[model samples]
Target: MNSRNDRTDLVDTWNGKVEEWPKVRFGDVCEIVARQVDPKLDQYAKLPHISGVNIESGTGRLLFLNTAAEDKVTSNKYLFYSGDVLYSKLRPYLRKALAVDFQGVCSADMYPLRVDRDYLDPEFTAWLLISDSFTKYADGESRRARMPKLNREQLFNWTAQIPPLSKQKTINSYIKWQFDKYIRSRMAAKAQLEAAETLPAAYLRSIFQGPEAESWLILPLGEAGEISSGITLGRRVSDRETRPVPYLRVANVKDGHLDLSDVNEIDATEAEIEKLRLKSGDLLLTEGGDADKLGRGTFWEGQIPDCIHQNHIFRIRFDPSRFCHRFVAAQIASPYGKAYFLAHAKQTTGIATINQKVLSAFPLMVPPVREQKRIALMLDARRTEAERVHSALADRLKAIERLPASILSRAFIGAR
Candidate 1:
């Protein structure tokens, strides 16, 4: 079946009547009026300069506009009036086109289209360009180009079903109403997601601060446990026999869990591997990179057998009889531990790092093993609930994003 004929027939059947509205070539109703001007000229230097990046895809929304002088634009641009529609010719699949309310100079990558008042409305034309039918046709034509650009000839030859002027205005109004609803829903979902993200920090602060923490036994980390650095990379060991072994990097360690997704292998002798191999319930902490990432780490569960870590990461093996690894990991991730690390960390430029001496001196608040297990269990339950809410909110935000294109398809293309 011919897809072009099928699209035309589908449009005709919208009202259960054949040929309810006349179809017309886009160029017949709108003219690409060129008024190219040098942006460096005194008259155009201060005007807001728009490019393809300025227009939001599938929603006719113009983002933060910058003046030609501020951007230091040195090329010739298409001069557009307040009522003109700016259509991006590059990457037709992005569906970037919008109606401007103020005069501006835009990059030549876009066309400044002026709709004939008697035949078409500017708002309706802007919406139609981002409609599903028009976008599909434009993408098909531009797909053959090396850079996926719609040439002038292909753009003008595009056809769409057009109703009378009054009907066109009604359709535009309906689309605008739907857009308002979509924006409100999106804003509410984003607010909920932001609130959910702050729960982790709050949970940590509640347990590690106040008079309750003062009653617990406090001990230095070096006296309570053993801390050792991992294998160093890029070292010469030609005389010694070596075998490839999987090792963790600083990137593999997260605040509360390990992301073993992209683990890499390094060449190390059997003796080096035996010394640095990871054990279940052992805590792994990073040296430091950014100020925020200082001493960030989580407990290892031995997910990858015989896996060792790089030198940038430190392994802490706590005494199993006295300390619960989960409870200790919870302390280090808390704001109290963060404050200690930040105060003792050596700063070079913007990056903060902690030496073995600083890490060994970390004051760990210790409770009975049974009490430690209870605290760890409570924190884990709260964290799990927060993550579940976060995941749900993120999925809702993604669904809300698809509303604009769906609304346009229903308004202009008669798509259900």
Candidate 2:
């Protein structure tokens, strides 16, 4: 990702492929290649100005929704129109810089250029840009490790093997067919994932929401969630490998349960482990925070036999008989819970902290335990299927990305 950020680089893999055919510089392709330079600032008009979001990998956004004055915006030097490719020349690891449609301004760091679409299929070229062979080189060659980048001069000079128009079109058609099929599969996956999340909420609402939403029992957080504190580790463990006690941090707690990645060992006596060791139903909450994270907590499914939560996280033990643990987990993940946490949170040294008082007083809703179990089961099944699609789409996207670089490898070197 670093190498691909700043410079125009040729991937050895793609280069090898291109060498098998007659090669030509990018300049020979068709025509029409240029970048815009204007609107020094305030380039974001009514149109959506792409930040990192415009990058496909970064989750592209077509609307520039921010109206605040404090948001930083890039100059118009990177403005692009539909069909033009705007790649993140900065870091190759971001692997995000790619085709952008919907005319708008972009970051100067991004290399935005109009290709000779007639000479080369724009779609075909997109696939090449995403190729691993080329991307890997760019990741290393483009920008510095911290911030990657690429420029126009090197990009224009990139060479590729030019097949006959007829041959090129045939190849494009095959790729397009595959892409079309992939798109349909991807759409289905998205639908499935959405269904997975929705079914749970619907299930809960069905069981709990009485006629006119007036009859179900509702209570504050005081009656629902029981608050328990995680142990304080004042001294850091010097030798993680030598330590026997597994410690949990905010990074390891995601969605629900303990994420193994954040688990670190600590020096603790048997007595300390007894007090700190987590039980099966304990929920983890953030006791501290950083700029990128709000310190919002997650659940630990008690996947491991024994592990401890750090001071930055709080242990929550809910009354499962009164409220379904799974439903409560989902509730905490809901938008309502997020607002409650953020609004009541106290900002100490720019870190949002949720105290035991507020934690115990929040309002909560619950559904019958039977329905909660059903909903959780249904959602898990759908989610699993959706995840499978997600994996496949990711693979297809990767394949499309590597095609152009593959073409280049053969064109420039005789290694295809």
In terms of lDDT, which candidate is strongest? 1
> RMSD for each model, in Å, please?
5.4, 10.1
Candidate 2 C-alpha lDDT tens digits along 364-415? 6655667667656765575566567657666665665554344433332331
Q: Residue 27 error for model 2, in Å?
A: 9.6
Error of 2 at 317 (Å): 2.2
TM-score per prediction, in order, is 0.91, 0.53
Candidate 2: lDDT of 387? 64
Stretches of model 2 off by over 4 angstroms after superposition: 1-214, 235-244, 269-271, 288-298, 319-323, 347-351, 367-375, 378-416
What is the TM-score of candidate 2?
0.53
Please report, in order, the local distance difference test score of every candidate based on alpha carbons.
0.87, 0.57
lDDT of 1: 0.87
What is candidate 2's CA lDDT for residue 94? 59
Q: Which run of 10 residues does model 2 get worst, by summed lDDT?
A: 59-68
